[model samples]
Target: MAAWLLAPQFTRSCHRQTPLTACKSNLKNIGTALEMYSTDWSGHYPPNLNLLTPNYLKTLPECLNAERVTYRIATGLNAPLNHGRFQDYYLVECTGTSHQDVNIPADYPKYTGIMGLIEQ
Candidate 1:
């Protein structure tokens, strides 16, 4: 009886989490594409995400659930760590979410690349 009563609540929560999970996975894949692009271009990230298509990325990944999400590139001022390169960059995503504080990392690039996906 208790299980039946609680099923609806669980279902509701799961629905919300599903989109968030998809968004996170998308962001992580974007980050991977960015990293690969930088490596091929001597540590300099592409001018925009579109540049990754058909090469580094097959297609631009969409925000799974959120609208008005922003992907930003933070360029490291220091010289490139690789051979005679010119730039270093970090990737971050600011996505729309249902909750205020459900931010999680994509766990890639050895840095905290995924930013908060706040309620819109």
Candidate 2:
């Protein structure tokens, strides 16, 4: 009886976390694609995320949250200042409010050339 009662709660918790997990995974994959694209392009990152498709990435990744928005590349004035040239440093972020339930690590830098998923 107790096991049955807890099953629903456990399932609900897992369901809530699915989107968050997917969002992180998507960001990581996109970051890898970005790195690969930069390497092939002689150290210059693409001007937009769409340029990564069918080459660096099989296809563009989308946010798994309720809004289901596409992840955006943070460049130009939006890119972090300490990361050197704007073309060398870019950040990818989900533009949805659904993933704010979880907190990111304090030490995690916004742009590391590998993965940068800002949840906001």
Candidate 3:
């Protein structure tokens, strides 16, 4: 082995870390929103983020820092859990960030914004 510094760019960790950090931050915020939502209605998550917006959050927290925000509402989704009612729930998640190193990508951008089953 020659010298570690004398290599032709072994790897670039910065690129990977930046996005992952941002993704993690978004996840934490989303989780907090989910928790607050549960507290408001007793074990029930908001049907969607917008429901929390203007309430749990004054305005959307800007999940992704990309063009067009890359964040949008993926509508017509199946209820996240067994509410035992006629399609009475919904969900929204963050996107446009990556966490490949830990295999926990934020959601959306990579998954094409399809979190769960959705119907009109």
Best by lDDT: 2
Clashes of 2: 0
34-103: candidate 1 lDDT, tens digit per residue: 6777667776677676776767655665544444334444445442222333235454454334323354
Give a tens-digit lDDT track for model 3, residues 14-120: 45435434533444445555556666675566545566565665445453344223333322334333344333233444453433344554453221122332211
RMSD for each of the candidates: 12.8, 11.5, 14.0
Model 1 residue 74 CA deviation in Å: 3.4
TM-score of model number 1: 0.53
Distance from true location, Cα of 77 in model 3, Å:
12
What is the alpha-carbon lDDT of model 1 when measured against the actual structure?
0.47
Q: What residue runs in model 2 are displaced by over 4 Å at the alpha carbon? A: 1-17, 76-78, 81-87, 101-111, 114-120
17, model 1: CA deviation in Å?
A: 7.5
lDDT for each of the candidates? 0.47, 0.57, 0.41
Flag clash pairs in model 1. Answer: none
**TM-score (all chains, Cα) for each model:** 0.53, 0.64, 0.44
Best by TM-score: 2
- In candidate 2, residue 35 scores what lDDT? 75
> Ten residues in a row with the worst lDDT in model 1?
1-10
